[model samples]
Target: MILKKHLKSIMSVTLAVGLVLSMAVAQPNLGMAASADDETYSGKTPKYVFMFIGDGMSYPQVSSAEMYLGELSMPGQITPEQLDFTKFPVHGALMTQDSTSFIPDSASTATSLASGKKTLSGVINMDETKSIAYTPITEALKEKGYKIGIVTSVPITHATPAAYYAKVANRNDAYGIGKQLAASGFDYFGGGDFDQKTGPKGADQHIYEIVEGAGYTIANTNEEILALNNKSGKVVAIDPDDYEAALDYEIDRADGELALSDYVAKGIEVLDNSKGFFMMVEGGKIDWANHANDAAASIHDTIAFDESVEVALDFYRAHPKETLIIVTADHECGGMTIGYSLTGYSTHFDKLQPVKMSYQEFDKLVKEYQAAMPSDPMLSDLADEIEDAYGLDINNLSDYQSSMLEDAFEKAMSGEKPSDDQEKVLYGSYSPLSVTLSHIVNSSAGLSFTSYSHTGTPVPVYAMGAGSELFDGFYDNTKVYGKLSVITKLDK
Candidate 1:
């Protein structure tokens, strides 16, 4: 798991330069100083804008990833490690509450981020009443002739990406969302396939047909996606191997597989124009991993998300003055904490390195095992599998830990439903054995989760390049859209 040489060099140069600047100015190397004159930022607009959303990311998620990388790079010692977006020249915090409650889902939070307005949970780009649609900044920019691109590790029509264009009362209306995506006429759309291409009941028009009829070239294979260039015109590129679901987690990604960074890099090539462009790239599966309470999987996805930010940073370096990059999250998920009671005050993030795949992937392994075995398998039967997948030594488990897994294994084997309360404590709607295994492994690494759902935590925002100073103050998530509006001079 060596860092790519080019990305490593980019990070080194940025860190070195930031250190020198900090020494020269006698201030912390966190962000560039804001000017006292309000007029200094007026009428300023970036020609190239990249907005990166690490879905379900917050301080805990970011810090754990940094610490994990630090441990990997320099074991047995404490050292500062930073992800690329964290090195930006502006830093801020965002309150994630929505109209419905303090704790929010992606639909509402993303709506506030995109439209400068509040909405009920599960609503997208509309007011709480859902009667009036709010024009998001992406549509505004598109109206002004800037090419727009939407990319995500999840299906394009998912809540976060849909906030940019699709307006729906319910986020689950994937068919309706797909129609809006086609009507968006945005320059590029790349990610997983539509979550629901033919409506929930399979009675609606195919999403692919709508997109093609709207003049988009669909690229569903690696070769087709790779061949897409600036001249490819309007395109929709999905991972050919996993067309129906999210791209694989970074920990599970294989050699030559397409990644979030690859999509962002391709987006820049296709969206670049004289009038400039705006690209929204989402690390969508970080949230999914977090929801499953898989620390190793979430950490790896967060790292992959940072690498996607690095792609934008590379672009920023080439067009420093004209480019603006903003990185933030919709909300925090999993209530992930760095220290666990079992480990007391010490954390050993390096312990997570041995984990080989995501809980989603491991669940598949469980299914395969069940199908192949002639008889019911015992907890002992999965020793080698558990060791290989989660770095757990089943034989070494304490009696209490062993008991918990044994009970879960029995429930999994019986194929009987557990009570809702039991489900929450044991699996939270995922495969029972998989969730239990992650809990065991995470505790070993001094990591734990408070809940298997979203938390009422505010997420951090990082910005650099043109108009980045405007993002330096703490605020509600709605102000994100306000700041971008002011930066780009979007009409109210």
Candidate 2:
């Protein structure tokens, strides 16, 4: 009873402190200490703003990536290598719950960030009733003569990016979202192409056709996009290779291919102007890789995301007093945790070095193997290929591990259904052989995932530059916009 009372007292004290911090931010002059002429909330608005969202990144994802890099550089040593954004001067936490559920989706959480409001999951830029639409900070900034750029590693019309410029009752309305993108009047839209060029039924006009008709230049090749400049009035730069889907995972990206950081750098080049610009860069593939429970892919993508933030950091150095950079996430996906049952209190992130490709790439390899071996292929027959792909020596596996592979291999090759509940747990929706491979490799690295969906976890917020001090406290995701509005006074 005494211990319970002490715990209650601690909770009470923490809540009271949080309330005090929130109240402090409510004051108009709580901006960072700066000169009278400095462009802070107390003075003029910041001229440049960059919002970097690592789609599924949270504390575990961030720490794991740092640890992986540290292990790669100093094998078996306890060095702590960190991402650039983590070293920002100010940090806070965001409660990601939307109006409806504790577990939030990208659309709703992103809406909360873009606009100071909460909506239902899968809804974008609209209230829960869907009758009233909320204007995102991007619109307000645009009205203030700031060019807006939206860049992502996923589809341009994906939920996270769309929340800034599009409003739809359902996120699946790809054609509608694409139309909104064409009409958004933003300066730049770079990354993946329209997920659905035509309507869902394939009867409507192509979105690209609409985009071209709306007077936007479309760059589909590397040379075409690289040649673009600030003079290239309005632009939509699509990934030359992955035109229909997301950009390649960092682990699978080929040399010279346009990565997320490339798009962000290009955005900086094109969006720079006298009045300034607001750019939203998303490392979206991190979420997809985590959803598939691929730790190596997730880590590489997280690193790639940090590289994009570094691009902004470089820009900030040139315009320190006039720039603001914020790094955050929509929500945490996959319930990712750093520790694993097999390696308690120890992590061998270097073991992940052998994972040369992502689970998606490995699935293609499985398909090729299946096609090459028409007759009944056995698990033992692909031992050499397994070793080559994931560096997992199949010959050295214990009987129990071999049995698991045999079951997954048979189901993958022969199109056999799981015999019971245990097999279902072994492989859910994903290719059985591929998921099993990821599970084994991830376990070897001392990482694990609890769910294949978004979790009810609060995401981190890292900020720096003008008015960054206002972000140094726990708050709801909606307060992200509220804080930005305070800095720029745009909502007024």
Candidate 3:
């Protein structure tokens, strides 16, 4: 009896100890659990990083663009060849942006990506107090002996492009930005003209001259850009103002004038040196058109932006493991939403042609229409002209649709609003027909568009090559800067 009792007591004690250990393991401390998942990433350091930012591109914009393109293909089907950046081996989403306010403007978001720090809205490469941030990826890359370049469809002094190089309290300080750009000592910079030479005569009327004097070759045409011998170490500036004439297309409506892809090709040509390079190519105008709710213009610009991605992908294919390419957007513009099935879903987007109207062309058309009707300041005449340009039939428009357009136009003409439904209809919103077509394409091609302005939502990020693994999960926008910095050895 004494032996049995001793054995039983020992068994009870062992069971009690086992239960205590189980409880301890089950209620692990938060810090310990976090540490358990923390992993050190080991991979080849990226020799080249190509970042493509499609300004104002939201998830909806990409989907819509894809659907639109797919509609143009056989049986309204899209293939790998039709995709601009589909070749990226790894893909994920990025937070749209985070500023002092939830809806971040381009200046803050771009600055965050460039400097690895968040700042107030409208600040570029500076903090909330307007002090320059010390950790710009460009500076970091330069410190590590990597060549750096920036290209964009909008003015080089625009927010997204300038954020990479210039520091300023306000993004509108284009003159100061331009001066800084000339002195940045970067190898390549190309884009449209900002109001660079707009002052009164002799009031420093030569910003291009300033750029040229700063050791850049100012080429006004693609031919000039093409003529540039690879041996020249000089910075090349393509005069975006004159690209249309050189290409034999009306500057007002030309589809390709210093296109993002073309600029990317040129950037690669110049910056692809022995030490490797870091290039940021932005389709900056997508946001501008989006803000105006110009659908045709925005979609066309998105397509152009995607073409630039194709250029980077070409480089990626050639370089394979040596290159890292990331395609993403700063934010979504116009609060663009994609679809509502009630609008007759049988139509597909493949039927529409890429819009060809330039801002100038639309302006000219509007003025002409206005001139034709002196008695009526209303858009009766202008509406007819717009219908002709866009192939719209007034008969098909519902009373509500017509009234909405008329009101929008009148407000625009009275200067109460910017240009009205002309800008919106031709480029911004899809008419019933267009929307129906979009749905059709979406059904077949897996594409569609939503809002017409930037949303508070996060955008997607598609990455490929070495160091791309770092971008696999949810991260702050500034973390992209750090990763790029480390990959390019900019952290040195």
Candidate 4:
């Protein structure tokens, strides 16, 4: 009896020991560089940080991009290319609702991410009452001597990017945001041109002039920016052509266009300083494309953002122990979901392969054609343009699709404006060609969108590198700043 009892106790002890060994192997040794065994960073503090914001990028957005990439695989290619950021060690769902409403706007959501607090819609860093104001993470880091870099695929003064630097009552206060961008006096700013050039209500001088007046060297071309030798001074580079308010969508960009990752690499080159740095790169056009219900365009822009992720990953590899990289979205726009009712359990994702130009480009194409052609041009003329832009076979189009285009073309020929309902469904633009083509392809591909505006769904968060373990588990959007503070030891 005594021997049996002793054997039982021994077995229990052996099992317990095995469990401990397994747990130790499963856990990562935080505060140490990914590739080093150096003890210099033996504590929970990051020296370098990167925060990537995919505007309107929620779970559906990420999943869509993944599946689309899968469909693009070549025949007999066993392993498809996955999104680079999905391999992050820590993942979480962030509740993006603000203090005021369930469906939050960009300004309020960005305010929550920028500061560890909730604020009203359209208000920058201030609370709903307009009395309590919070300093942004960028401002906080800037005060600590960390170099700051901001890059976006939209206007540098857009809501998400502006939340980090500008504090204002209204997001439409573009001129004010532009002035703040100049006066922020951080280190680097790269993206599209500002929506407003000067003052609160359209002042006389251009915004670039103010930025240059503040001692920033503005670069307009790829060669000019890449060859920049002025490492000590602040730099600002925006595309010189003011065609669209933001950079071109990746799907429609011309040859030799600078990609989102190129901007990220350039910002890193310019902002890497001795005191450390905090840089933000935004995939702003993902939200814009989703707003237009353009799945192909959104996926291409998401790929662009992933390329920027790769750029940061190379930097993280070199300084893994001191660097922290986080990728998330401020809100979920378009209420996207897979498995559309038309396809049930099956979908033809390759149907999206035919889409070429973006909805905006298609709208512009029709307008230009109409302006140059005679008043009573035949339907084949417009049909040929649509076929060319969308890869649609007009002969194969359903009658309903044909009628949709015919009515809209007739309206355009008569110079009639789009109705309120038409505008809401088609991204506030008059384009039956774009609407019909997208509907035909997207339905077959099993992609669907619930609304044209932002949804209250929680966005996904992916993080890696030093201090990355702190980002796991679900949390409020405001807690982003808190987690960042704890992980980086910003308060200490």
Query: What does each candidate score in C-alpha RMSD?
Result: 11.8, 5.0, 10.1, 10.1
Q: Write the per-residue lDDT of candidate 1 for residues 429-478, one digit (tens) a residue.
A: 77889899999888888999988889999999999999998888787787
The worst-scoring run of ten residues by lDDT in candidate 2 lies at 28-37
Instruction: Give lDDT tens digits, candidate 2, residues 79-178.
Output: 7698999999999999898877889999988988897678899999887888778788899899999999999999999999999899998899989999
Question: Each prediction's TM-score against the native?
Answer: 0.90, 0.91, 0.79, 0.86
lDDT of each: 0.87, 0.87, 0.66, 0.79
Off by over 4 Å in 1: 1-40, 420-423
Query: Which of the two candidates, 1 or 4, achieves a greater TM-score against the reference?
Result: 1
- Tell me which residue pairs clash in candidate 2: none
RMSD of 4: 10.1
Candidate 4 lDDT trough over 10 residues, lowest sum: 30-39
lDDT for 479 in candidate 4 is 71
lDDT of 2 at 249: 90
The CA root-mean-square deviation of candidate 2, after full C-alpha superposition on the true structure, stands at: 5.0
Runs off by more than 4 Å, candidate 2: 1-40, 416-421
Q: Summarize candidate 4's per-residue lDDT along 1-492 as a digit string, tens digits.
A: 999999999999999999999877632211111212111233556677999999999987888888888878852343345699988989988998876678999998888888767777888877677776678889878888889999988998988999889888888888888888889997888887788775656656888788889988888887877765437479887765435668899888888887788888888888877888899889999998887778888888998899999999999999988899999999998887877886898766677787888888887877788789776666678667767777777777678767766665676566655667754564335355565566666776899887778899999999998877767888777777877766655666
Candidate 3 error regions (>4 Å): 1-41, 74-82, 198-202, 239-256, 340-355, 358-360, 371-373, 376-384, 412-453
Tens-digit lDDT track for model 3 on 274-343? 7888899888777866665555556677787888788878888888888898888887887665553434
